[model samples]
Target chain A: MIGGKGISIWFFIGSLLLLYGIIITIANVVEMVSPSVDKQPVLHELNFGVWWGILLLIIGSVYFFSFRPWKKK
Target chain B: MLGNLKPLLTPLMASSSSLLSLGWVDSLIIIIYFAFVLGIGYYLLRFTKTGEDFFMAGRDMTMWIAGLSFVAANLGSLELMGWAASAYQYGILATHWYWIGAIPAMLFLGIIMMPFYYISKTHSVPGYLKLRFGEGASMLSATSFGFMTVFMSGINMYSMAIVMKVVLGWDIHFSIWVSSITVLVYVVLGGLLSAIFNEVLQFMLIWLGALMIPIIGLIETGGWSGMVARIQQNFPGGDYTHLWRTMGSFQDNPMGIHWTGIVFGLGAIISFAYWTTDFLVVQRVLTAKDLRSAKMAPIIGAGFKMMVPFIVILPGLLGLAVVMPKLVPENMVSAANPHSYNEVLPLMLARYAGPGLLGLGVTALIAGFMSGMAGNVSAFATVWTYDIYRPIHVKLTKKEESDSYYVKIGRWCTVLGVLVSIGTAYMVQQFASIMDYVQALFSFFLAPLFGTVILGMLWKRATKAGGFWGLFAGMFSSVGMWAWVKLDPSALKIIALSEYAKDMAENMYRGLWCFLIVVIVTVVVSLFTEPKPEKELVGLVRGCTELPSEGHLPIWRRPIFWASIVLTVFIVLNILFW
Candidate 1:
C-alpha cells in the first residue's frame, strides 16, 4: 500500500538528514558558547534539551496546521 | 606440546574448587534457573503453531509483559556489571549516561518514532526499509542487522565466560562451553515465547541481584550515612559525592567523565538506533497486542532505566570506595585495570557478599547474561525465518503451512543462530571490554542505516538512489573517521577545544561522522534528483487511514507534541542546574 516516487523519497531522506545535522550543529555551537571554566566541573557538555525542544516545536507546528483528525471523506 | 597443554590444563585444575566453592546452594539455584528456562521453552513449543507464533508469540503480548521484556532484554549481565565497574573506576559520571543518553532518546522514540513505525506494521525494522526505499536498502539494512547480531552474540558469550572465570573460577573454555550450551538448549527447543517468558524470570533475578548487592554493602559498612562517609574517607576529591558532579575526567575521578561522550557520543545514537530501529527491541514491540501497548512499552522501559544507575552502578562505587582498600594494590590494580574492568563486579561479589547471599548474586548474574543471549537468539531466528526465509524460499498461502512446520523451522533457526553466535563469541574474546567492542561494531553500521531509514520515512523527496548512496557514504565516512582517530589521535585536533571536546574529537567514533556525511550527501543528491510520486509517498508517510480509530493521530499533531516541548525544557533545566 505504501509506495513513493524516487524524487520525493530522496527529498524526504535529505531533509531528515539535514535536520539531524542542524540539531547536532546547534548542540555543538551551544557547547562552544557555554564553555566550562577549568576549575569548575562541566555540568552539561551538549545541550540536547535545547535542540530537542526546538525539534518538538517544529514538529508541533507542522502537526497543528496540517492535521485534520476529524475530517470526513 | 606438553607446555601448551599445561597452559590450558592449569585453568581447568583451578576451576574444580572454584565451582565447588560456589557452594551446593548456589549450584542448586543455578540448576533450578536453568531447568525453569528449559521448561518454559518446552511449554511454549505447542504455541509454535505457525511461523508467526514462534517468531512473534502470535502477537499476543500485553503491554506490561512486552515493556518489561524490553528492559530485561537490554539489561545484559555485561551492561550492569560493566556499569558497576565503570562506577568503581570513574565515579558518578556513569549514571549521567541514563539521564543524558538513554532517557531522552527513549522518550523521543516512544512518541515520535514509534507512531510512524507502528503505522507501517512491518514485522522487522528492515522490512519497513523495503517499503520506504527499495529492496537494495532493505537487504543492506538486514545484512547489517545480521552482522550486529553476530557481533552481539560473541560479546555476550565472552562476557558471560569472563564472569564465570572471575566469580566461579571456571576456565575460559569451560565457561564458554557452559554458557553456550545453556542458551543453545532452550533457544533450540522453544522460540520467542520461551525467550520472553524466561526473560521475565531473568528480569526478576537480575533486579534482585542488582538491589541485593548495594543493600548488603550498606549493611556490611554499617548504614547509608556511615557507608557514604567511609567512601568519602577512602577516596579523596569527593568522588563519592552526587552523581552529576562526576563528569570532569576519564581517569581516577569517578564522576569526571566527559558528559558529551556519555550523552551524545554513546547515548543519543546508540539508544535511538537500538530502541527505535534494532530488531532486538522492535521484536518485543511487534509482538504487542496492539499499538497502545507498543507505545507504552518503551515509555515504561525508560522509567525503569531511570532506576538502573542507583541499583547497578552505585554499588560498584561503594565497592571501590569501601571494599577495595582492604585488597592489595596489585590485586586491585590487576582487577580494576581498564583491560580487566569486567572483573570489577565479580570480584566485588566474591569478596564482599556473604555466603547465602552470594548464591543469589551469582544466580542473578547468570539471569542477566542468559536474558540477553536468549533475546539475541530469538531475534536472529525471527529475522532469518521471517525476513529472509519466508521471502525467498517459503511462499504459500499464509494458512497452508501447518503451524508445526513454522514452529519446527523457528526451532531450527534458533539452533543455527546460537551456533553462529558461539563462533562469533569466541572471536570477540580478543577485545578488552565486551561493551566497547559491541558499541564500536554497532556504530559502524547503525549510523548510516539510521540516516537512510529516517530519510525514507520522513522525507517525501528522498530518492532510492539517495538513500542507497547516502548509506554507503555515511558508512565509509564513519569508518574512515574512526580509523583516523585510532591511527592518529592528534591529526584532527581543533584549536581552543575544551578538554571534553578534545577528548570527544580524539576518541569519537568515526561512524558518527560517517553518518553525518551520508546525511549531507544524501540531502545534496536528493535536491538534484526528480521527485517521487505523491500517491506512493502518501501511505508510506501518512499511514493507513481506513483502520478503526483508536488512538490515531494526524501525521502532524498530538498531545505528545506539546509534552515533548515541556519535557525538553525540564530536562534542560535539570541538566544545567545539576
Candidate 2:
C-alpha cells in the first residue's frame, strides 16, 4: 500500500516524471543564471531539459488530479 | 538564448571513440540514471507477486502507460541508430518506414485488429494463434517468434555495442554486459511490468536526448529549407532532401526502393507484419486493464509514432549536411563504409549536446538498448512459458499446474531467454550493420505469422491446418528467396524493375512475396480443409462477434477520432516532406 492499491499506474508515472522534470528545470535555471555576460549556455535556447520537465509535469498532473480516492460510488 | 550560442564543433571526427572524451559530470549523470532504473525495478518487484502481475502488470495499466510502453518497446536502440543510419545513407526515402509503413498499419491495428486480440483475453500473441489456429500453428509461430525475438535482441545488443565502441571507445564486452546485465537483473526480478515501466521512462529520455539535435541543426541551417539547401550543396543530383521525388523510380532515388516497392513491400507488408503482429510491441497493449484501453493504446502510439521520424531521421540528414564535411573529404559514402552511417546520431550528439547534456544523451542510448533487450526477453519468456512449456508439461504430467508454478516457470524463462540472447549477441559480432539481417528475419517470421493471423481473424473459414501450413509455406518462401539471391546474383534484379535495385538486400520485396504466398496458400488450404464450428469461432473472427461500442467520450477523446487526426498528420507530412 505504498502508493496504495487504488492508485492508477499513471499516477506513479506522472509523479515520477513531475519530480524529475522539476529537478531538471531547477538545475537548468541555476545553470542559466550563472552564464557570463554576453555569453549564454546552449541549454537555455533548446530547453529540452525544461520542456521535457514541463511536459511530464502536465501529464503527471492530469493523472494525479483525475484520481478520485474518496469516490467509492 | 540558443540562437546566439554557436555549436562548439569538435575538431576531430572519426568512427572510433578514442578521439572523443567524457567528463566527471557525464559519468555522474550515467550513474544516477542507472541507480534510478534499478531502483524502479526493485520497487516494482514487491508488487509483482503472480504471473499476471509480472507479465501483464496485474492488468491495471491505463491508456497512456500502455500506449507509451507499446511505442517505447519499438523505439529500441537499433531503431534509433538504424533508422538514423538509414536516413544518412538512403536520405529521406527512409521516412516511408515511419509514415506510410507505420501509421496505416498502427491505425488498422487500433480500429480493426484490437477487438479480436483484446476480446480473446490471450496473454501473448502466440496464445492468440493457439486459440485461432490450434497447436500446430501456435507452436510454429511461437517457436519461430521465440527464436526471432532473441536474435533481434542480439542485433540490438550488437548495434548498441558497435555505436558505443565506435563513438566512445568503450570496450565491446563492457558495453554488451553493461546493457545485458542491467536489463537481465530488472527483467528477471520484476518481469514484464518492470520492463514496461522502464520503457515509458526510456521513451521520455529518448525524446529529450534526440530533440536537441534536430532543433539546433535546423536553427543553424535556417530551418528545413536551409537544411535542404545545405544537403543539395553537399551532394548535388542527390534527391536526398526530397521524400517523394526520388521515389518515382528505383534509379531516381538514393535508397533504390521504387515507389511501387515502397508502397506494396514496405508500406503494406513489412509495416503491417511488424506493427500488427510483433509480440514485442503487441504484448504491451495486451497488458491493458480492459479492451477499451487496449484499443486506445495503439491509436495513441500512432500519434507519437508519426512524430518519431523527426527525432530519428532528422539527425541523419543533419549528419550528412553538417557532420559529413567535418569527417572525411567531400562525399556521402556511409552505407557500405565501415560503421559510418551508425555514427550519425552520436556525431550529432557530439556537436550539439555538451557536458551534462552529453551524459543524458548517452544514457538515452543505453536506455533504448536495455528497453529493447528487456522487451524481447519479456516477450520470449511469455511465449516459452505459456505456449511452449505449459502444454508439454501438462501432457507429460497428466495434471493441471498451479498459477504460481507457471509464474515460476516464466521467471526462469526470462533468465534462459536473456542467456540465449547474450549468445546470439556475440554470434553476430562480425556484421557491421544489422538493419538488413534483422529485417530479413522479420520477413521470414512475421510476414507468414501476420498472414495467418489476418486470415484467421477476418475469414471464419481459415482452418487450423490452413493456418499452420500457410505460415510454414510463407516462411519457407522467404528463406528460399534469401537463398536464391545468395546463389543467383541477378535474382533480385530480375524481380525488381528499377535500375538501382541493388542498394539493399530488399527485405521489403521478400516480405511482400511472403505475404502473398501465405494468403494464397491459406485460402487454398482452407477451402479444402474443414473449418471450425460456428459456436467455437465466436469472438475470434470478424463476422462471428458483435463489435463493442466506445463509451460516450467526446469526439476528440475517442480512439478512432484520434486515429483519424494522426492519419491526417501523416498525410500532411508526406505532402510537405515530399
Best by DockQ: 2
TM-scores for all predictions: 0.75, 0.88
Q: How close is candidate 1 to the true structure, as a TM-score?
A: 0.75
| All-Cα superposition RMSD per candidate | 16.2, 5.5
Q: Candidate 2 — which residues are off by over 4 angstroms?
A: A1-73, B1-20, B324-339, B430-439, B497-499, B503-505, B551-553
Alpha-carbon shift of residue B118 in model 1 (angstroms): 2.1
* CAPRI tier for the interface of model 1: incorrect
lDDT of 1 by residue, B322-383 (tens): 65433332245543442345456666566443323345567778888888988888888777
Residue B3 lDDT, candidate 1, scale 0-100: 53
lDDT of 2 at B48: 83
